[model samples]
Target: MKNSTPKANFESFSFSEDILSAIKAMGFKKPTDIQLKTIPAVLEGKDVLARADTGSGKTAAFVLPLLDNLSNQNVYLRRGRDERFDSSKRAVSN
Candidate 1:
């Protein structure tokens, strides 16, 4: 049977600039098999379980979607408080 997974691209999904920038900075050319499988399901709020070799684009698969979700909700997370804040870093109340 033919495989049914639709091809995915970072630009095809509605990711924030920071996430896309990070992806570019990380030199991610495209999604790996694991990433291709996991990213869409995770974005859809579905649980996924996958395993791939080291150096696979696993981190991006999870982090990118989570960052995108947070960005959509107007919750920006940064490591250092000393850094200047942009509107992307606005805190949202529940």
Candidate 2:
């Protein structure tokens, strides 16, 4: 398999300048697989359900895009176990 870490960069995601600077300052040279798959979806305000190893940079995958979007108030983070939305959707559809 190809090594995603070597070619995966935060720049391709089109993150804000501040976030990009912070990413550099934080020494995150490249994104893990999970981050690569999740960041854009989350940034586009889509509901993302992703799973990865504990140390696979899951936190930053969601947090960075969220922080950049905070100014526009477009953040809504829901966990995988949050089934309340499912129940509500069923009820409304019924």
Candidate 3:
């Protein structure tokens, strides 16, 4: 998808404050054309299928948007239970 807004340095795009801080700390100052095009679409919840030449910053295009979603959701983390409680143990013994 083409953007009507003229491309600017990636730093100029308004992002969530945390995301912007992390991007700056990672030392990225500009967006490659793929990043410029894809990030916004992904942020807007569009399913994107992009084709780009090697080394065209495709990784950042996907990574940044995905990270944004994950960070926003603040997903839960849980530990597994002991396997010894399984009902299959009784079936196997029988």
Candidate achieving the largest TM-score = 1
lDDT of 3 by residue, 1-94 (tens): 6675645776555566677788889788788888888888887889899989998889888888777676667454432442222221221211
Give lDDT tens digits, candidate 1, residues 1-94: 1234656777766678888888889888777887777877888888777788998878878888987887677444453665433446554343
TM-scores for every candidate against the unseen true structure: 0.70, 0.66, 0.68
- What tens digits encode model 2's per-residue C-alpha lDDT throughout 1-94? 2223332689988887878999999999999888888887787888888888999999999999987776445333443554322321231221
lDDT of each: 0.73, 0.74, 0.71
Model 1, TM vs. native: 0.70
Model 2, CA-based lDDT: 0.74
What's every prediction's RMSD, in angstroms? 5.1, 10.8, 10.2
- How displaced is residue 50 in candidate 1, in Å? 0.7
Greater-TM-score candidate between 1 and 3: 1
Candidate 1: list runs displaced more than 4 Å.
1-4, 76-94
Candidate 2: segments with Cα more than 4 A from true spot: 1-7, 71-94
Clashes of each: 0, 0, 0
